[model samples]
Target: MSKRKKHNLQWIKETLELKEDHNWKSQPGTRIFVAGRGALRFDVPQDWHFEPDTKSFRFLDKKPPNDDCRLEASFNLLPPGEWADFPLVHLLKQVVRDDERNPIEQGEIIRLKRQTARIVWTQFKFIDPQENREAYSRICIGLGSGVQCLITFDYWVDDAERLTPVWDTVMESLVLGLYIRDPRTGLAFPD
Candidate 1:
């Protein structure tokens, strides 16, 4: 087993801001493999398919063992000082301002572990007019050193309560690597 790094724990905790009832006791979601370097580990209820190529996890309502949930997460490595160019507040508003998107709730969330960092939270309608399905999405973006991680949890409007917990689990269990691997040498992440 590849050893998980502990140095990023503070950033994870600050971004998550978990609630009281969260299952913090080693709850494993579905195991999804990421090609090339590392893998993402999290536990989703069951029957959810994670497509690594697209970096999307989805389970359709019409499908078998239907979970009626759709979740997607992406990590974008930003250029040095890129985060400063696009502040979290501006990003939050931009999401709701364009494409006729309406936000049910949106704001900046507290970074419990870091006073300097910013995390934005937004809930909006993700409409697919072609499919006639309008899903409710909860997005949280955590700005980190040269990295911007976006975790989106969406489900059919009626299934929000049932599927929200799955999203919560992903947020609580998420662990991203801090180091870049060097095939010629070994592991590298500056201390």
Candidate 2:
């Protein structure tokens, strides 16, 4: 058999080379955190595993490939000079519609808008195919300046007593950055 070469795409190369400390990072605290890219300033439970990605990240509360206990966050940022053309609610609805499975129970959209940011979210219950058990999830989308962040938290219903607090902590502290840039130096800031 002949050996095949690995094809490295532009995005794959760029994403692979992104160092943790230089790009995204989590500062020490009671909960794990994702802080960078002007996308999020959010945290998860203290014991969860932190996994990184170019435009998204995941926090696993349990071992992978099975069971339902994890949180995922994805984001998009507009170019410095541009502003969002679609309303926040529009994006929020799309997220709900795009869920992998039809939910058994769905809560109303909870929305909060302020000068700093506007956030919309809801919780849903469904049967997770991989785990073959009832799963609870919350999807939150926030927009501010030219950045938008979407956070999804999924857990087993039986574990709500333990996981609910983790979800609350995340929503309470979620902060979307303005993504502003300094004229002299193009680096982002705030810890």
Candidate 3:
């Protein structure tokens, strides 16, 4: 068999094995991300597909290579302190500062407070050079209950019509589920 890359785009689907992993478990419109001390819950449209990776949990509205319309969530298990201890804007500012991309726009910070739980939120739209197109992303950092959960979503301009509602659903539905215990072990996690 020839080792040539298909059409120079660098993928030969039918001739490739294509995986180290591909796993997902879904019910309706929700998915749970569990960490050592806590868990995060968010809305992932039931119609979308899930991709497994070692670094983070990835969900997409379409298949790979077409995965520009996607969401990425990272569970930060090692936060320095509890949410109430830090000045909200300061923490959020650090997050926005760490990004290397030049964002074209920024939105107001949304602080989601549930009793004592707090999740700081904001979004930015920028052009992703790797994607070679203008893309928008919503970033929310849930800072409370001794944990930090970051969720970022990116979608190309062309797919906004189909992807916007999915974004709204996620934004409204994302919540930090703190210390929900498992039935058997009784550790912190969702059932």
Candidate 4:
């Protein structure tokens, strides 16, 4: 058999890499997720596993692959100058739309901004006929440094009341950051 040559594509070369820090295990209260881009960092629980996309970090409350106890979060950095043109209402419309192009039952969109951070929280509820139970979720859009980051919490109606408190605690501890350049020095911040 002849040997085939190895080649790397531009996209493949720039793909993000996920790594678990040994230091996180040794430290008592510090947990961090570092993306290969050096521009993204997340303060995540030490036990959560990185998702395939590298943009999301997932933590399961019980055993593996159980949707009932999953928390999913992802970050997206918008292209330069795109934040100004980004419409929250438009994005929300798309997010809540189902396969039939219908909006799910949702509450009013609440918007808040603090310093450089702008956040939009949307509450949604729908009945999952297959599970014979209601489904609830909170979609959070946090904008900082022109980046829109999403943090979603989903659970069955049965566990909604019990998991409400749990989600609050987790959201409080979650931290997301994007690299910012020092205008004076024109240099990107170190990871």
What is the C-alpha local distance difference test score of each model? 0.51, 0.68, 0.63, 0.54
Comparing 2 and 3 on lDDT, the stronger one: 2
Candidate 4 stretches with Cα past 4 Å from truth are: 1-55, 65-67, 82-85, 98-104, 170-191
In terms of lDDT, model 4 sits at 0.54
lDDT per residue (tens digit) for residues 110-175 in model 1: 331232334566677656454567677677666655556676665677777777677666565554
Clashes in model 1: which pairs?
28-43, 29-42, 29-43, 29-44, 30-43, 30-44
Could you estimate the TM-score for every candidate? Answer: 0.57, 0.70, 0.68, 0.60
- Give the clashing pairs for model 2: none
Off by over 4 Å in 3: 1-38, 78-82, 179-191
Error of 2 at 9 (Å): 12
lDDT ranking from best to worst? 2, 3, 4, 1
Error of 3 at 132 (Å): 3.8
Ordered by TM-score, highest first, the candidates read: 2, 3, 4, 1
lDDT of 1: 0.51
Selected candidate, larger TM-score, 3 vs 4? 3
TM-score (C-alpha, index-matched) for candidate 4: 0.60
The count of residue-pair clashes in candidate 4 stands at 0
lDDT of 4 by residue, 43-160 (tens): 4445544343434655554444543655666677666674644677668657766423132577788776644556676768766656656677777777766456777776776887
Candidate 3 per-residue lDDT, tens place, 1-191, comes to 00112232332223224233423333466554443434566667766676545546678766765555768777765555544766766777777777787888887888777644577777777888765677777777776555567777777777778787776676666656456453234344333
lDDT of 3: 0.63
